[model samples]
Target: MLGPDGIKDIAKMDPREGAALLEAHIENFDGEAAMTMWLQTKPKILYKGGARSRFAAAFHPRENKFEVEVLFSKAPTDFHPTCNQIFYFGEELELALKYAWWAENRVPAEAACVLQVALPASKMSEGVYVDDAKRWERLVWHSRRVDSHGQPLEAAPDTVVSLLNERILVGPICGMSPHVVQGLPRGGWQRLTKIRLSNNQNATQVVFMNPRTFVERCEEILWVLSSVSWRGNSSQDLLVMHGLRVQPLNVGQIAAS
Candidate 1:
């Protein structure tokens, strides 16, 4: 996995160079192969305890939609195939894959697997709906480390951004109550997804803004991963700079299993 030094190296380059480099890393690494290796070789260190175990997203051009499914050990699997979140995408599969890699590299290994597999059995139509207008770019996410009881463990809100901007990169292990919201939208409509990461060494809060186009979104996400100070406790943090490949199975195969 890529490390903080790798990210810092990319940050020194211009955006175009940085993006190209990031793409190279993503395309070259095989995320599925890596997972197989870990599952086979290092069985005990699979994922952060209570952290997400599997995540997968797919874009169906025919449907013009994107679906993201997250599976946590805590969530009940008795339902058989789990549900996911759905949103519309204006771009093609290539862009979807790029964003997928970026997201996969940002978190720990277990959560990162979401990038490698396709949840065919996971029904898309059954997933929760996400407003396309309220895309990931539209909101800023905020996370803070907290004890099991859920309290801010470090850094004030005013200091968080600067701490991120300046590379302070300090926060709780496995974020506490992480929430997102759009800047312009006020009151109730502004809020987005909120979940807790079970580890420490991460930012308490995060936010997002949508770009005008798909390429712009990719560039912005790459830039953030390359430059933003990440405080993940695991080595997977900021590893997007390296080659982490994913072999997403087809919908039919996933569904059959």
Candidate 2:
């Protein structure tokens, strides 16, 4: 069976051998509940770059699907990406086998897997949502409380220009006259204002814009992952600078019963 120590040697083993080891570990558990309990052990595994990898395995009973996530650490102070990679399989045994195979063959040579654990599917999803909500709340509060100068807004034109530059007043510039909007910055703000006006059907238009803030971008990535189908083999450049690899595997046969 594969233990925490065995992960370091996985790179040297044939992909099939690594797969078999994972399969053996999965077979020891009776069901999803049993597997979740076993995962509480939180095995610490090391891969390349001496970075630790954390693992999260989850089974969605309603979908009859299994998911394994490998989250990598960047720095001691940096928040780890929600997941560095995600592997989905139709069967539990298949999940274990394909995950082992991918870890052995595909994970970059310099990468490391720091944390690993199992979780219920519902809990995993809930955690993601909760984290995102907190971030969104924080973003909204920041937007409302301060202008681009990082201070409270005043009636000054400079403060308005600062807000426009930071994209705080993205929609129709309420309370401000057309002359004031036109008097602001010349390049991006001018173009954005024209675009908004051309699309506006009403005098008081409320347009929603994505500031592409860090939190917003994170939400977009998560939405894409959750909405897509993950049956075929594919890869995504999810935080490539951090050496995270997201991919799928083709399973020929079940390795465990």
Candidate 3:
């Protein structure tokens, strides 16, 4: 979420794109307003990660499995402490979708766009702990069977659990709901325009334009993208998506030591 200051910096850096995009924005309002409109309706990025990181996954429904091996950027320093557990290979997709749905619900109908989000590097799951504990496996079972407070997992009116009894105890299916699949870092379930590599690294930013893509990634880490900068290492700028009105856990919010 670029504040007045952040947006101003963009205007300074890339006047061409900034002015062009801003011109479109101003024209949309019949040129009646000034900078306020741009500030209020900031572009919500679908996702922003490095070319090498795992931004998207190819899901083969026929095979009932997906493949994503690209390493992701680490969680931000500020966000690391808030994360309770890192996700595994499959869990990341499901969690991201759930978070996207949650965020979409909170957005006001009149609001030009959903709130811009920001994430740190530390929050993302490091796949799984590389040890004998098999913590990732255990966590998956626990998440399916119990709530954060250790209570039984409950199903809403028409939740995934309600529709399939198997999902209650078992983890999500390889070919889960489209909602989850759409959250892939590369974009939604279907490939839109193929993004080609260009001299400008920012060109590939669209790979994550699908709102769901950001949602799932963010949910895994429990962070909301606040703002994005196309300035330096684009990979470092890449952050995760967030759950709906879900307030991210913060150090200040936790009980004092």
Candidate 4:
């Protein structure tokens, strides 16, 4: 995948030379600058040793208003489909595909396949949902992971945002959701869908965002996710750079997936 090294190569060139490339490529360029965002969430285990999903968002910068979904189709981190997905949101096409590729790589080949070919396939839907104000974006997703289901391992508040800018004042575990008038609004527990993994069809469903944000345009997601994928019992770490090669993402940047 085209990575940080590739991003700098474009900036090192003469402004006029790079500008020509940007003009024909980057749709969101401003003056001599171009911006993109990357959003990420790592896989978390709920049932101790069974099911897992990359539901954590590791923050980094890229662009804005992007959508993504990685399939755990084959089991663990398996190969991804080479097709770029068309989605309900996001402005960049190439960036989305690159992000999905990185996600597929993060998963183990077995679980990844189960997530795709088992869980969601058993209970077909347009896709998973998170009741909120965000319009689900499906523009770029390609995972080959698979999963079967049970009550997802319960998650606490901390699992929502790993690096919250400020600590949330959550203490009362006994109060009802709509408890106060305007403290944090009345939201129930996180929306969890119990997907049944099967040995039959290939279960698959793309993930969506509730509210898209800056530096989350898709390409950046590749970097942040690759970083998170290094978590394990091992002492050493591995680095994998994700890249895209589409019409818009293929401009002045030099990289591949």
Candidate 5:
């Protein structure tokens, strides 16, 4: 019965050994239920797409079995999204540090291009939005259990409607590349100059600079993003950046502590 304590023990073990244990008790294991229990344990370091030194588990519907895999890198060809839904819980700064490390090591030069295209200047742009909608439709079609004659066992009209009405949060459009001033270190700042809207052509460029290391910059970006209040339509109410610059006051003490 893989209880909460067992899940905690598995979290502490080597991924391979933990997976072996899970496979040994496969009949009694339940992936979704176990994932809920695992999350309740609140592990500080987890990798989403099976990075090394983390535990990832998933349920295979076709096989009707729970499978556990050691967290490790795969060739881009071998990656599967459903089987890689791992999560980590930690301080925001710690997560940002991991992102910075991954950005330095794993993120390729082409990633910036991909990010730029994925998040276009126009909200209803014809690139990522279109691709994502098609993907969602395909997923809905595949999820239905149908007979050989192509009739669904269950009704799917509501699911299709829900997909159509989904509100995607395409974040603010800003300069994709960070800029470094003359005297600053290699780590640069991101400027959120203007917000692009249909009728708002005369919007002024508001520059916000942070001359911190890559990790600190990543942390700041995460903080800003999470702090945004989506309740109001006004820019000031939406993204309240009142005291964002106050981080510099204690920047030197952060590393030491």
Candidate 6:
């Protein structure tokens, strides 16, 4: 109902031919309101890295699985920490969708209409590291069910017990009703999920069916995204997972650490 074809065929058409159709589609599909809100809402990005790092990423926890996002920018010598985990595969960022629209849309109009989002470098997953600090420190920000490569592994257990031995902080999933108290991270049983270390180079990404019991407030799930500059190296020759808000740790009251 939101796509172009759902209402009418306009996904691919001449700018003039689809111009009116796109407009109508936008109006009918609440595209305008959503766009306006998206434009107006100031999406807040929760970064889990200190100011010193050249790049950072975070996760967003929605329902079953989590989505991780990262960002690259310039930093100065005088930088401070702005995240929970210090040594990680990558820093985390908490982005509120509403908070982003306003910030992005307000930019001054340029001669050419353009939209762009920076993604991570692909084909860099062999050693399973993304951030320079992470690679240098051999930190495991996030990991799939494999070692450094994409090959499937069996270390990841379905239950939390498997992670306990690794010293990685284990938690519950974020979105669920009557949440499953204690279970495995297999199949659809996952929830808000937690982060833990599998080795020095990587961390495990598991989901839970119950989050409230484990985590106070869940918002984003931090993980690394695969991206490369316009023209960069080959896809991740290794494996790498960054960070995002897997289940946004509720930071209602700032606690003194």
- lDDT tens string, model 3, 26-136? 223222232332333342222222121123232222332223212221221010111222222222222233233333334441111112223332322221221222322
TM-score of each: 0.22, 0.19, 0.21, 0.20, 0.15, 0.19
Local distance difference test values of all predictions, in order: 0.26, 0.25, 0.25, 0.23, 0.25, 0.23
**All candidates: CA RMSD in angstroms?**
17.3, 19.4, 18.9, 18.7, 25.0, 20.2
142-249 per-residue lDDT for model 5 (tens digits): 222233444433354554444323332112222122121112222222222222334544211111111122223221211111111112311111111110222333
What tens-digit string does per-residue lDDT give for candidate 6 at 68-99? 22231111100101122212222211111111
**Model 1: per-residue Cα lDDT over 48-157, one tens digit each:** 11112323222332332222222222211111111121112211222223334454555552333112111111112222222232321121232222334443233334
Q: Considering TM-score, where higher is better, how would the candidates rank from best to worst?
A: 1, 3, 4, 6, 2, 5
Candidate 5 ranges with C-alpha deviation above 4 Å: 1-11, 14-20, 27-46, 49-58, 61-257
Candidate 5 C-alpha error for residue 123, in Å = 36
lDDT of 6 at 64: 30
Which of 1 and 6 is the better model by lDDT?
1
Over 4 Å off, model 2: 1-23, 26-50, 53-111, 114-118, 124-257
Q: In terms of lDDT, which candidate is strongest? A: 1
Candidate 2 lDDT by residue in tens digits, 11-98: 2434344334444443332344333332442211112112213232222323323332222222110011121222211112122332
TM-score of 6: 0.19
Name the 10 consecutive residues with the lowest summed lDDT in model 6: 72-81
lDDT of 4 by residue, 1-257 (tens): 22121122221334354335434434454533322211012111111011124422212124322223221122111111122321122112123223333554546531210110011121213233322311111011111111233111222233222211111111111111211211222232222122222332222223222112211233322221222112232211121122322233422121231
lDDT for model 4: 0.23
Q: What is the lDDT of residue 137 in candidate 3?
A: 23
What's the true lDDT of residue 174 in model 6? 23
**lDDT for position 69 in model 1:** 25
